[model samples]
Target: MSNNGSYSNDRPPSAGETELATDPASGVLFLSDYKKHEDLQQMLDSNKDSLKLEAMKRIIGMIAKGKNASDLFPPVVKNVVSKNIEVKKLVYVYLVRYAEEQQDLALLSISTFQRALKASEFFIPVLLVDPNQLIRASALRVLSSIRVPMIVPIVMLAIKDSASDMSPYVRKTAAHAIPKLYSLDPEQKDELIVVIEKLLSDKTTLVVGSAVMAFEEVCPERIDLIHKNYRKLCNLLVDVDEWGQVIIISMLTRYARTQFADPNADDDGEDSTNKPFYEDEDDIDGEHDPSKEEKIKKTYSLDPDHRLLLRNTKPLLQSRNASVVMSVAQLYHHLAPRSEVHVVAKALIRLLRSHREVQSVVLNCIASVSTKRKGMFEPFLKSFFVRTSDPTHIKLLKLEILTNLATETSISVILREFQTYISSNDKEFVAAAIQAIGRCASSIKEVTDTCLSGLVSLLSNRDHDVVAESVVVIKKLLQTQPSEHREIIIHMAKLVDFINVPQARASILWLLGEYSDRVPKIAPDVLRKMAKSFINEEDIVKLQILNLAVKLYLTNPKQTNLLCQYVFNLAKYDHNYDIRDRARFLKQFIFSENSKLSKHAKKIFLATKPAPVLESRFKGKKRWVPYHTILTPGRLAIMTCLLSLKFLLILL
Candidate 1:
């Protein structure tokens, strides 16, 4: 390594590095001699099973690692795509993983990637469309991983073409492809509705599961279109398949809960009497308090008349399916905040207290619902207070949920509860309390102040989720209270955390962006630390940072000169237009700040007045003349007669 410690910039050999004539070994022109790829190709082609499989496996790993083996992919994909069935499967797996995990491959031009995707079509049909049921099933699984929209039309066509295919698996895979297609275009949702409506009636369980999952994902957006066919969807929710049941019930209960919460009713309670379903009454617990006006304000903002929704929520709480029950409990926990909220709150407490598999879902649901409802949250808080010493995942889950759900109004109570829990000296219990306090750091001024020590304690959590969640909370607090959160934000900046989970680096970068102000104070080393991560981040995160830079520039232009420079450079050279567009738009803010451009921009802005372009174009243009003009014979005859009569009268 050089003193500068910079990586080498040597260009790898092109795919055509080896010419056919020059290489005596395989006589293949495009093969590189140094890699001996030609020899492996020959061995695989010679029908030596052991050697072939070994070579395939090694190549698979190479492809996965994206070996400086660029010259190898095109030939490898071409040769293996149509080879033995096993070879095809292995190759497809490598390519799919390449698309999914390897960010470097995103640098490949769109056209090249499209060609590789098109190559997969040959296998897609064999895996999804061939006579062998297993091969076809395997193909469907692979296609789901492709994540390309262009394949949607082909998959949709296959579903239509193979309606009578013998394999139920094939038919089922075809049905599943429809929503995956529709997810790319919401306009295609109606078309998916048609496809799913047909598949819901299929006798096969696989088909039923596929159809129900599609409806669940798509229906939230297309519910109005499916209103007429709602019964069919509702009936399918009872199918014997567990997954089908989970999805359908989740969709139904969620929609029903929302509708019940916001049922349109006449003032003076006239509509309630007519509609038995829309009952407006107090909650069963009757612990409702009017003292917490902020709670009521946030609750009513989400749903104006909780009375009707809470009335209809009874059956959902009683749902036989665990998922349905959980979804309902969650929706109510978040949306239902009247004194009657104890109904769902008690239900969640019972579910949590029971140590069921659905306990976490229930706890998270309680957290979601109780966020703004102070008095309503009090019962849950009291339940947790008593259950604090209980050594169960349920207890831990409850603590974690309550921590996240704390708002400005509830933070004081939560902090008091945490202080009480500290006496127990149970590390995990204290950890849970600390983590929750971290989530609410920015929620209240006092919470922000109190969370500092807890957040410091949590920085060493071995669990990445805990650490990352703590960082997120710290970031939120810093963004919320930049001045007072200086120390805490500074503490968070020194952390060099690497989360191996995919798509998470973006969020972590977002946290950095949120705390960028404290970069100079808490961590003067933030930019240098995150430089590599920013380059390796996904487009979404890049856009987020660009946006954050714009926002920072908007608030404090002088401090953000370096940030603006980075944004402009990225906008000019970034691989994607989305990044470019964001950078370009953000540049306007910086440009507007400049005194010279400000004058020019104002002049251009004022001078570029709206013009009547079409009207001006028509100014000197001739009007259209019909090719064969009609004389209006009858009208002309009447005019002549009138003229003759007038002349006779004048002569007389």
Candidate 2:
């Protein structure tokens, strides 16, 4: 390769690779790269150290230029025995570059790296306080990893002194070394805890995280040591690196939960769940300003340090690091007031734009938090809509989040997004969309007509899974409002003969049998169709067939007696034990005048069930506007936010 990135070939040209030269036969203008490679190879085999070092430097330069030089590995490995330390370092640097792709070559060089370490006790202490931070850190790590039992005393002494080293880099290294020493000599764990506590109070954010880690491993029971450092750790949380912030924030969250009273607990005759986080209710939505009496509510109170922690911690939600954002969000959930937990919602939503792995974890947090404090996420509903390119897991979580965010005002827009999802090529996504629609209908009464219409349209879908899952969600909705969706029951019963999915078949039978009073003529017809194929049907469908048969027998004993009897007889001799037992119980209940429980079988199958409240934590409670979040910049505290986000409706 020439310097200007244009190739000059003195030898045969590579395939599709052109050479730039004024003369090709005489080779007047071009430099020969082939001869340059051979010259460098000859220098690597020389007896003098300087020639080998110079040759290795050229190889390092070639590797840095993105050139393949695996042919030089054997020469580099031979140079590790050089008396010059710089030559060994350059050779190792070259070897490390190709370690992953050249695993066999790296294995051949393992003993070479091991031979470079000086692990003797006589020379160990001298390197522990070396002026170079990398050497000081590496020396301790290598010494700790040495397996000789006699070297334990040297490793312990080296760790104790280095734990208080002037360089924070060395102290952080010592923190990692403490755990290894403790593992080798468990007797020194308590003494190591004392050393770790000093490292924790080092007045540097650099060492505090690792010190706490060492403390966690050395003596986790010694949390009493953390009390003095609690305020200091909170102060240094932002200054710490991303990983350090994750560790410290997790430790602080655990500490705050146990020491402080619940942030949601009623304080001085006030229920925080019903109150919003802001001082004025009119600030969040500009549409209707509340009256003065309702606008000014008492602030949800907190302990001083808790207030300081939250005050200092809110800006980290915009961190470039995903784990840092996640850690801060969790801290708010665990320690902040109930009304303020929604502060993490927008931050978590922003993570959807990240890579799929981070998006997955962020979605899980959204799913858990939205189940309890859904109103907190209401403003950002469109952020949860499924993207066309999302993976299956992300799509599933977004579906759950969108379903949980459904409300009377927002259900219309949510149903519109669900309509698009129902048409996707992925069957699982289609089914989840169908389920999301059913959930919206079950939760919001106004949208039940819309969700039912969408689901009924899906019953005509060409994909079998879409129609099957649609039936399952529709069954749940119909069971909840058995009388309101009478028309849906007739439509579902029409597809029963053509449907082959067991869950869908069982769901169809359940809707027909449970609401048999609404579709009386279709009930016996479904039962007659089911009785002919009862032997081939799944156990689930078979059980539902018995329930449908018995429910129909109670409604009209004269017209459906023989049809019900045949289903019962086929079920009685079925392969499954549960099916047989259920069949015998239903047949005895309906056909016998001998049992006392048979008289009121009508009341058993046709009992009226109350509508299910969507399982959520703050469903009935008032929506909360999280702390430090205000639309109008209502106070000086809003200025503390690092970045203010204006969430817009994401247009499809």
Candidate 3:
């Protein structure tokens, strides 16, 4: 072996190598040439630079070969961590490649790595919190992969320091790392609570927001802690100047509802159905009795069943803040798992009866919640059920609520409800109803076809954004319901011609990709409309339109040679590197024999290679307007056309 990375040992074969050690899975020899190991160990111990480098390469290769050669990393870490600067740099480069190439082996040497991590104080932070953002980010990633319980406090300290770090990227990376620590040790939930307290007080909005989100991830399992600290957590909810009250309240609610689950019920334990929390002492059946004298044994294995979090926290449902009220209702749904259907149903009704804002918030929460708790659907559907007799606000709120509940569980009911609303001739309500149905179509095929019947009328409606949102909805619906709904789609294609907004134009073209073979019957015309959008659109819109064109070509390669032409043109002339990259991806996607786009693969390589000075000048400019603006030019053109109008369009 030499410094250039090659095997160097000259020793004879060991007995382990003479006999084949077959693996059960791959049916390959478990051990290879033992002389390779002998030479590697000798070179690793050698002072000669060439042999040492050869040892480094051999160690990496041995680890790659799935041998238990990671026994050498402790010695390797001891050697590398003590080396001088140039040697240390070489060691780091090697370790990083090893970390990247054979992460599991590195992980196997956890105690060895931890010893280096704890002793060489600089390396931990260098990887996790270096002033160089990339180094800090990459180090946190490696540390997270290690998953040792002892590192929790160390990781927490780093998180606290990162909260105040100047770079948003570093802070965001730190925020992500906080959850990874919990993944390694769920018992660190209390430490996470402390981190959340500091994060909520931090000066940076991103830090505070990230901390609140991290709390939502780690704090759920500690519902008893949240129950104990309800007043304190809720007090923070009252701090008037706080901008993240919604997230804080949402976390508290999620914890109350989801995390404090009874493991007995979860695992179908026999004792789960026995009402352990509220058991009447005298009513215990003799047959079901365990040792009556047994004391309550404590272990972290089961979370304390804090049913009181749900039972005691109901008053917050009447709190003035809509977010608080909504969260309280959501919490009841989780904590009251025994009869949660009634609990959520009643709380939602109470919220609806009091305030419009509460109603809207509760409605959003109920959409997804009701889907999971579909048995509660009938009662909730009736409570917010859209009717001519109801107030317009109630009717509008009901439509939104029904739209929200249209996922896997409740889509069938939502479809049936849509027919009832569409059968009536109230055009205004009918339009709103169709939009709600659009929301449902994405989740279920039955509802998508039911809504597809109204596409012709929706396409002709005066409201363009409703039509546009409907187009987006139909695209999603077509994905699941394509074979059965092909005729309805042919009608949708005729309506596609009426949509002039470039955003809608691009969306319609993208949707056609789902039915790539049926582009002729669907919206082949949309490809041309989307392509034209690139001519005068802002660079951002042009980029999106270019993506849409590429997607269309990819979907139905039979009709769209235009994708290749679009890419070739951009690669040759687009001023933006991103635009050139889009062109490159299009070229590779169309021409590469493998044809699969590795999503995580770097896109920059395919990006237009920089033209030096021109690339640097345009580097940070806002390259493109949003696709919605391209779709509806008039709305963007208007100065005070009421952003409220846009809001209404969005809910539709």
Candidate 4:
């Protein structure tokens, strides 16, 4: 070995020469030759720069393929002291990868890493302040990878100096290094907090994002740190990239909630705040009070911070980026004053104009938000109308929002639009549309007649699925408002032949049984027709037929007694235990002639079910939107692993 730059020509071939070769098919060089670990030692001792670079490349390729390159750590460590910047970068990469894996050997390379950290020409300050941002960033990265507590002070100082560097790229790298330092010595959090907060005001958006990320990781609970920067964060909320927007919005929401401990200081409780200002005609007995409406509007304006967050975030709802829209919407939903949350709700509706995949996500967010603030979105009901060009999923989601937003003012428009969907050629959309119409009917008494008329007309639809779904919805509608929709029983009976589905048949049978006294002439005929396929009918149909038979016998015993007797006998011998048991119970109950039990059964069968209503999608639930940040556990782990591997390829 020679101390000078030159070495004897007797040195062995580098590992690159002994182990790597080019594949003919892909034209990519790969490590194919399996040489002993000592071959790497011989290559590292060589004075040839080209040979060393090639050997390091080969080692990095091996490491990338997930091979154990720790055995070569000794020679790789020696190369870290090389004057060649490229070789130093490759060596640093290899050290980061194997540092934690080969901690013992990694300790031997710390001195070399420190030397590179401070390496510079006579007039150059240090590698930390190197002219090339890449070199500067690489130096900070390498220093961060050394996890020894004893070196924490040196790494901390390097990060602090790099944080103030003129390069935004270097400043971002320093922001990332703060967490690594804190993890090595958590007690240093106080020391790093100052540096992290300073980076928050960096001129570059990327640097600001990185700084916020650092603050979240080091002291997320320190609301005081965020208090001073709250307005700045809101103003910069839109400029940061998508991921940064998530962090900043989440932090702002936390700060707002903390500062305004009682969100209902002027507003009501959470549920009351979500209640819509505009009520249906029935809510006020069809009378509109001008003074009350004026009072309600006056109470709904936004507070200072809430107004600021909304002002900054409202524009983000129109962002072409889905993540930005979702984050801003979630922030508004969780933190905005109740009176102004409607603005955010409408903003989310506008996102439906984006791509289909995005439309689906936006619809889901709207659905979740609408449960809390339904009236806020009622005015935007037209926007959710299904577009013929939308994908099936989007169309279905749009239909859901439409139904959710249905009210006295919007029901007529929604019903008319649903009629068009029911006539669509797409069977699935038609079925969903028919169901939507039925749901609207069940919810709003004003639309019950019009919706049922539309549904009854769909019985003549050519699509069997459309007819079947129509019958299902009609069944639900009849259950909800039996008295109001009883006239449709005749139309439903006429469509019994067209209803081929088991569930559809079951629904019709239930309708016939419940309204037997109303449609006595046709009810028995429908039950008898269903009985012809008694052995072949589905279990659900069988159960409904059994119940209908019992009800028909009770309601119209003269016309249905013999028919009910035959069906009950067949069911009593059926293979299914449930049907058999039900048959026996009905027979015993009928023969016993207990008037009280008979009346109880009649009342139970004829009782009106609660109207079909959309349950709160997010009631008693925290409004959560999935957003990725550097502080997340999975992201942090992946970053650590990738940083290690990337350093190997770039430096070693």
Candidate 5:
């Protein structure tokens, strides 16, 4: 055994080295690590699993402390063959940490990990015989987390037995285990399906939510398995824990969407008066489908099962859990007849008053639905108004909803709200406000002049984004009725000197060029000013300046002839290829002697083109606005939320 007196820099100290006796800080730490490594090697080699487990933990502790435990890889990899699952778990964990660097050693553990994966004997005994239900439930929960393919039958057996267990706690844990069991060995899907069916039929509401959740995951397409359980699920929808309610409601929504006729298919496009649904108003309790008496009376248009599902879900609109409310909101959104779809709006508006994040999600749902149908959101227009505490994203979402909800009656109110947004310091948001102003103008023609007047006023706004966005809005308004808006075009032309933003500069140039006669005096001077800064201007402005110069020269070639020749010659040598190419084309077109096209430069450049068809950007944005997705139950998210609930319960 070498003494600790002299340490080798290239090699670790021998297992015989005791205390660190080196001079340098790194040598001392290495020597100290060698001694611990030697102790760990001894502990790992012990026949006692406890000692090996302790060594595995210490290695993990070292790794956690940001120390290099890669030296322990070979020793730890051997323990993957340990009979104790806990010991194997720690060993495999250590191997995963350094598997890339220790490939040969890690490969040695794969067969063992695969073989050990089939071994669940350790948890089975505790899960089966533990007197404490929590211990039994937890044992089964832990057992489910084991990724052993061979343990499926044993786990399935345990799940089947636990599904019928007297304690709801054990049954709930078993219900949760169905997904893990299916994940470990999906071939056992047939057997797991039997188990899920049994769990769904279990009388406990707590177990039912999880059972439905598992059913959705393992056999989501197997709606037939849930058909008999449909009435039961509708009855239990509100009774499940808040987390369970989200899952059950979401499942019911999917089931209803597939199972029933589209509630609005028969309706002509007339305003269906919202049959007002207040909390607990004529609410029927008990496991009742639509009664024979109601069916004979033809009291509802939706199928009996659909109506039953809607009735069962409608009251939960008031659930404190935002997710629960959203789930029900989705229920009404996809399945409710138009008359009843409006019922979910009040609840959605209430949610916008939640904290910033909640408002953001709920606002999206409202936006989507508002686009689908308008009046539902009109009443809550003020609720979507920006609050001082609202973050920039929340403010933008609110602005989108406000614009989507614009009616002739609401347009005045919404445009007034946009005025406030324009004045805010948030540049991105201020720009969106300006764009929304254009959308509002586009959506409602009655408010065209009103929105244009608002935009023209914002051209003088100190914020560059506000001024820039305002220029775009004015152009769109002018495009709406180009001839009627000659005055607005002239007004934009007058402000060209104050607007310096690239897009704003380009926008002014485009309008003046498009309607040059409207501002004949201003157009020539604007082109010369733009020409002075042509090299420094953005690509977009430069392109517009080129087009404007061509248009103006074509209008009166003799007057702009020198300006054209000079500008084209300057652009010809510019660094940008597109600009240079465009310059060459224009210069040739204007001066070509035998190039027949040059003779008709005025006919070519001054030809009147139709106004561009403005696609409602609001229409594109409306697709993302629906909050339905945020509340819709996702497969993995359900498990995560349930796991969190379990963890919280254990903490309590």
Candidate 6:
């Protein structure tokens, strides 16, 4: 017989007839006899074991490739009683593939599978205790694949027996089998949980990891079962594989959250035994209050179990694996005490020495932590300074962190760093640097003069982007510090010719209109020069110019009446509806006989605008929780199928 399950002659081919023949034209094997189900059925009924085995392999390969081999299930099951191990293995492979599709027909194989599970060779159970670990694991896997509930007891006995096998490989395989049994029949979950909990204490890390994974899938809500083994699992956490570490950390995080009550609650609605002491009155004359001291001490304290978990996890911060570090950091941030959060934050910073991708993630986590716990990362402020070799995204993240950590004590150090960044050739970095400086000046009053001075000096930068960004920062600064920084008007006036970008031009025009009375001579020329290019400017610049022209006319109508009229005339016939409407409203307000409405319009736009503060993108949002998985549903299915295939291969 050929590999295609077709006999070349009337009688079966001899042992040497194992070679397959190919078509001369297509270079493909020509299975002329096995094209239909009848040919494959005939081959399965042949007396020769080789022919039956070849037929079974062809059918399985077809089924694996998504062909319909359901009609051959009866013929495939007939060979289950064959004495040849190789032939029986192939038949078992065929059964597992189509069993769920043809459940009624699969019931016929339960008796044969049970007999094979109990088969003995020279008084030794060959299938279960075979010297080859793969053969033993495979036999156990196949027995578990039969989803019929009638065979559940048989499969359970086999799994329980294999769980204690001397081979660690068999023990691991047994651990994975628990979830399969529970999934097949939810009633068996309690019994399987008992079996899984025993394997958790198994000395082998491989078995323990697999066992915890099974527990996570089968009995995740029953976390109390792990309380007895919590210390042992934490001790072995670092020694497991990277993926296993993620699972253990997630489990520990859940356990910690459950074990400890809400930290924010002074009384967790529990009995008096769990409540800590509190002080009801304020201290007088700066004297120490013993009740306040006790409350502070109790808030920072941790129970023995949580303390141990944190201690074991601290070393993982220096781990070479990025996922491990991130998981540990998230665990500390979510469940650990606030006072101990600095330890994890420092660990995240250490991860910056890794790749750029890791650096970006670490910086984001650090930024979140620092924002919540103010001044926690202040001592190590210099660690966030941008390096020249860092990528653009990473540089941006570091700059944000620097801005978040700025305060009275660290403002000077951060300002010096910003000065260096402003001189860099990267236009985006310089722009961000200038913005960061302006934010610091807005928030910290002491640094206002120094930061504004630094920004004023950057207006001379040759790069148009840098100069444009400086104009924007200075505009914001003027909104907050208009009285002290009137000197910036002279410097901004000198840069009118250098500013060509629409946004920059709009900023300078807005400044002149708001402070027109401060620099009256130079303001009109800037507006007239901007008026010449009004037809070609973008909508944003045009809108700012119109508003500035209104301001110029209202403040200094003697010298700027015609310039404002030219802008209003150009805007009145303009295509944009917003511009035309504004032109009409301003014309009515400025030249109207209704003095009451015109004064109201003047008072509204002239009011002091609020200062801009540096806020995190995640401000006022909930803290982020990292996702960890023991085994996803898709992965579980794939693992079950692969184990079934391995069982069939071992028989061959």
TM-score of every prediction relative to native:
0.40, 0.71, 0.39, 0.69, 0.73, 0.64
Backbone clashes for every candidate come to: 10, 0, 8, 8, 5, 0
Which parts of model 6 are misplaced by more than 4 Å?
A: 1-204, 207-232, 262-299, 374-376, 517-525, 553-562, 575-599, 618-652
Candidate 2 on 1-652: residue-level lDDT in tens? 2332222323555679654332223333123353366656666777756556656766766665577888777777776556566665676577657654676665555444343234443334444555767666755665565544555666677788788788898899899889878887898876788788889898888898898888777887677788777777877878887888888888888877886667777667644343432233332222333353243234654555566567667889989999999999989987887777878888887888899999998888788778777798899887887888889989998888888878788888888888888778888888777877877887787878777787888899888899899888888877776777788889999998778899999999988877888887888888888899999999888888888888888888898999988888888788899998888777767998776557667776777756655444334333577765645655644544433222111110
RMSD of 6: 14.8
The residue ranges of model 4 lying beyond 4 angstroms of the native Cα positions read 1-26, 30-136, 139-171, 174-207, 217-219, 235-242, 261-320, 334-353, 370-385, 405-413, 423-426, 553-569, 577-600, 614-652
Q: What's the ranking of the predictions by TM-score, best on top?
A: 5, 2, 4, 6, 1, 3
Q: Which candidate has the highest lDDT of all?
A: 6
**Which has the higher lDDT value, candidate number 2 or candidate number 3?**
2
Q: Name the weakest run of 10 consecutive residues (lDDT summed) in model 6.
A: 276-285
Candidate 5 ranges beyond 4 A from true positions: 1-126, 148-157, 267-300, 585-652
User: 2 or 4, which is superior by lDDT?
Assistant: 2
Q: What C-alpha lDDT does candidate 1 achieve relative to the native structure?
A: 0.53
Give the 10-residue window scoring lowest on summed lDDT in candidate 2.
643-652
Candidate 1 residues lying further than 4 Å off, grouped into runs, are: 1-40, 48-52, 62-88, 98-128, 140-153, 162-168, 179-193, 200-205, 212-220, 228-232, 235-246, 257-325, 331-364, 371-383, 386-652
Q: lDDT scores for all predictions?
A: 0.53, 0.74, 0.54, 0.73, 0.74, 0.75
Q: For model 1, which pairs clash?
A: 18-29, 19-29, 20-29, 127-136, 260-309, 283-340, 288-339, 333-369, 334-369, 490-522
Q: What CA root-mean-square deviation does each model show from the true structure?
A: 24.3, 14.5, 26.4, 14.4, 13.4, 14.8
Candidate 4 local lDDT, residue 61: 75
Lowest summed lDDT window (length 10), candidate 1:
1-10
lDDT of 1 by residue, 100-139 (tens): 3433442232223233233444322433445567566545
Best by TM-score: 5
Residue-wise C-alpha lDDT for candidate 6, range 390-424, written one tens digit per residue: 87778888888888888898899899898889778
Error of 5 at 323 (Å): 0.3
